[model samples]
Structures are given as C-alpha cells and as structure tokens.
Target: MASNRPAPQAPFAPDASEPFAYGAPRAEDGVWEEWNPTEESLPAVRGRHRVAKQRGGGLARSSTVLGVGVIAAVGAGGMASANTGKPPVSIALPDLPSVDSLIDGHHHTETPAASLSGVATATATAVGDSTADAGEALRSRIMAQAERQQSKADSRATAAAVAKADQQAAEAAAKAAKEASVKAAAAKEKAEADAEKKAEQARLAALAKQYTLPTSSYTITSTFGQAGSMWSSGYHTGLDFAAPTGTLIKAIHSGTITEAGWAGAYGYRTILTLDDGTELWFCHQSSISVSAGQKVSTGEVIGRVGATGNVTGPHLHLEVHPGGQPTGIDPGAWLRGKGLTP
Candidate 1:
C-alpha cells in the first residue's frame, strides 16, 4: 500500500570537501525539507541514541546471553558425549526437547529459534546429572576394591596362624613320642635285669639239693696251696680236716669208688669217680668202709680218719681232680661252690 511518507536517501555533503553532512529525504510527491542541529534538540539526540537499548537491552546484553548459551551448550555436549560414547565438539549448540512434551510423553513440534532458551537450561541440568552419577559410580568401585583387599589380607593372616598352630602341634607330638620311647626302653631294661636276678637265684636253689660235705665232726686243719715241708709237691694240693681217729668220713657226692687201698704217702686213700668224670680223693683214713667199684651215695660213710701217711695227726685229706685228671684243684673252694659255707 502506497502512502504519503518520505523515501530515505544518502546524506548530501553540501560543500564538496566539507566534513558536515545532512539527510536528503523526499516525500511521495518529491519535496525536500531543511534540517539543522541545535542545543534545544540535544535531549532528543540522546534519546535517539538510547532507543534500541530501551527496546531490548541492546547488543551488549544480547552478547552476554549468547555467551551463557554457548557455555550451556558446551556443558550439554560434554554430558551427551559421555552418555553416547562420542567425542565432544569445541563449540556446541544444544537442541533441547520441551519439558512440557517430555512430562506428558508427547512430542512438541517447535521451531529452533523458539526453543533455544529451554534447551540451554536442560543441557546444563543434564551435564550436572551425568557428572553426579559418574562420581557416585567411581566412589562405589573404590570402596569395593578396598573391601576385597582387606578380605585378602585377613585370609593371609588366618592362614599363617593356622600353619603356626599345625607346626606347633606336630612338634609337640614328636616330643611326646620321644619321651614315650625313652620310658619304654627304660622299662624294658629294668624288666630284663629283674628276670636275670631271678634266674640266678633259681639256679643256686637247684644246685643246693644235689651236693653234700666230705666229713662230719671235723675241724679244718690245713688249707690248699699252703707251703709245707711235709708235702711232696711244692705246695699242699689238698684240703685237710683234723678229726678223731675213728671219725666217719662221708662221700662228697654220688659216685663210684674207683680205688680203696693204701697209698705210700697218703695212706688208706680212697678215690670216688663221678658221672661227669670228676674224681674226689679222701686220704689218711683210719679204715676204708667202701670197696672199689662200689657206688656210694652222698653223705654215706666211705672211710675213717687216721693218723697215717705224711700226717701230723689224725686228719682226712680231700682233693679234687676235674675231668679225672691227675692235677688236683683246691678242695675247700670246690666244696663251698656247692653251697657249703666251709
């Protein structure tokens, strides 16, 4: 629609080289009007300069809002990158869904320019939420790792204690076994000693019943191996018992009388031969009661004491010849070994 308004044009420099200029505006019928500056219009000029700021806070405020929007967009981009596993861009502008549509589960068809403010707010909130969630997950993982390490340490300590106890128990068992073995050995040794003592006593008891003495009512006159001038050998080889002239002299053991005759020096000597081939001689007897080849029992009278054959008085000489050899052993020691005290 055409109206009676002015057409705006470039300012005209009235003088060619002058810095002063003025607007050349034409009405619809093509008429020019004069314009000039004055102190009276100074307030009007200042008002014209502030017109855009009064309308919408001017370019500075718009730049501040745009900067805040850009910051919000970058934060939202970081959150989106974390959520979607993508890299973030250096400058990002957000495309936000409307809160109303999201709350109602409905789609809002909006123009990009119309929804910019709401998208920036939602992007900041999403960035904050994602950061909080990641912090919480990291804290949980660290706490779990600490708990597992503590459990492993506790298990190692418990195992060490158990192993120590087992080693001590094994050592104790070994010590007890050693002590028991020592005690058992001592007991066995003692038992063997007692058994040996009892066996010796039993042997002596049986031997006491089998032997007898050579004479009765007699006093020991001479010991064996005594140096004397009356003896033919260098030492007297027989034990002598001084008795009455007619005293009875008994056989020392069960034996056969091998000889009952006069010997030149040991007159009226009688020899008794035992089953084990040992010979006993009873000499200087007043009279012989047993004949040769006669078997005589122990304690039976075999001869009488006489003062004959290299004797100072009436005495019986007793000699022992082991294995029927001619060499005589000491008779007093042999008699005492058969349980006789003399």
Candidate 2:
C-alpha cells in the first residue's frame, strides 16, 4: 500500500578525505574527480529495521500498534466462530509502518480497534434482546392457556350445580302435586258418602208420615220362620210382640178391617187389609177395637196385647199375607218394607 508519510531526507555526505564512508563520494588513485550517488548504486535493505530515532519513539509505538491489532483480530474471529458454529476466519490487518520508516520520522495511519469491538458488541446485544423477547412471548402464551383451562373447569362445575338444583326442585314439585291429588280424591269420597246418608234420612222421614208401629212399649219376643213345636207349622211363621196386657195396638197403615173376632187358637184376632190387598193380621189380643168393614187411618188404636190362646206370655202375634195367600210371609220383614222396625 502507498504510505501517507513524507520521504526521508538523506544523511550529510563526508569530504573525500574521509576513508570510504557510506553514501559519501571518494577519489580513486589520488586523482581528484567529481562523483554523485544514484538509486542503482545503493544496495537494498532487507527486513524491518530496529534503529531508534530521536524524533519518533520507534520500537515502543510499533509494539503498541501491533498488540492492539492482534487483540482486535482475535476478538473478531472469536465472535464470528461462536455465531456461525465454524472455524475462525482469517482477518487481514492494515499494514503498519516499518522500523526503518518509524526511525526516519515517517508515520502511517492504522485502523482503530475500538471500531471492531463496537460492531461485535452491537451484534451480541441484538441477539440477546431477540432471545429475551421470544421467551417473554412463550411465557405469555402458556399463562393464557392455563387461564382458559381454569375457566372451563369453573363453567362445568357451575353447570353441574345448577342441574342438581333443578332436579331437586322438580322432585319437590312432583311430591307436592301427588299429595294434592290424594287429598282431593279423599275429599270427594267423603262428600259423596255424606250426601248419600242425608238422602237416606230424608226417605225415612217421608215414610214415617205414611206408616206407624203396631204397638208401643213392646218387645220382640219371637221372629218369623223360627223353628219350634209351639207353632202349628214346622217353623214359626209369625212375629210376636211381648208387652203388658192391655197395651194399645195401632194400625200399621191406612187400611180397612176385613175380620175382627175371636179365633180358635189366635184368641181375639183382627185382620186389616191395605188398599193394595196386603193383609196384616194381629192375633192374641186382649180386646179388638175395630170391626170388620171399618176403615182406619195409620196410627189409629186397633187392639190391646194379651196372652190369649197358645201364648207363652202377654204378646201380640202378627202375620203378613200378600194377596190373601194361604201361607204367610215374615211379618218383621214386611214391617221394615213399610219403613217400620218390629
């Protein structure tokens, strides 16, 4: 490379009398002749010269520059090797001034080590910042994913809780509805029973106005169809009312007296024939108050109870015969059919 330093001045030449001095002209064989030095006449100097000069600090400055260049090159190579994962690259340094030029007071400009170091520092800083940014982004993504998972778990728990609550509410409502239904059915059944009982009472009241008992203060001593030897038939075919002698007997219903007189085994008997042709016979009476062909209203006095013929005590025997049949029917059942109990 071309150097920016000024050319060095030549040294002073000695007189011809000086014996063979360098770069000085000398007379040959004592004959006085003029001589001049040329570029071809000087021999070439080899290698770096270590000569010190008074004007410039020679070897010390060169050593300093050399050390700085070597350090700069090592830094650049090491950085390049580390980044590329390869062998260090060779770095070409700027040519430095030789010792001869330095001793001649010639200076050369060199590249600064600070500039290379600055470039390396800037590149490393950029790589470090990039790595930091990447790590931050990854951490942010992980945190966001964790939050989403937690939110999903919470939603599931809430849904389960709501469903359970709804089920409980539904069950409670169903139970309440079932209970209400049962209560309504029971109320309906009770109301129907009460209404039927009231109707029966009303019917009995109406029948009471149409019929009356045969006698008062009497006890049922015998029922009809009772088997005994005391009766003419194999079974008793009449109802017997036991009472004190002379107790008054009343007509069971509005009827006409068909017969009233003393009978062979029935003592004083009275036969009352209803308008429907049903006959009610009152036997074993102490006295008869109605005569044949006489019309009597219900509850009218008819006869008195007595222990007459074939009687066990003071009782009035009664028989019912529909359409004047020869065989009699049960008198107690016949009385109940008229809304009366015997």
Clashes of each: 1, 0
> How far is 137's C-alpha from truth in model 1 (Å)?
13
TM-score of 2: 0.51
lDDT of each: 0.76, 0.78
Q: Write the per-residue lDDT of candidate 2 for residues 259-324, one digit (tens) a residue.
A: 999898899999999999999999999999989999999999999999888887899899999999
TM-score, cand. 1: 0.46
* Candidate 1, backbone clash total: 1
lDDT per residue (tens digit) for residues 227-281 in model 1: 9777878789998888899988888789899999999899899999998999999
Per-candidate TM vs. native? 0.46, 0.51
Worst 10-residue lDDT window, candidate 1: 51-60
Q: In model 1, how large is the Cα lDDT of residue 92?
A: 31
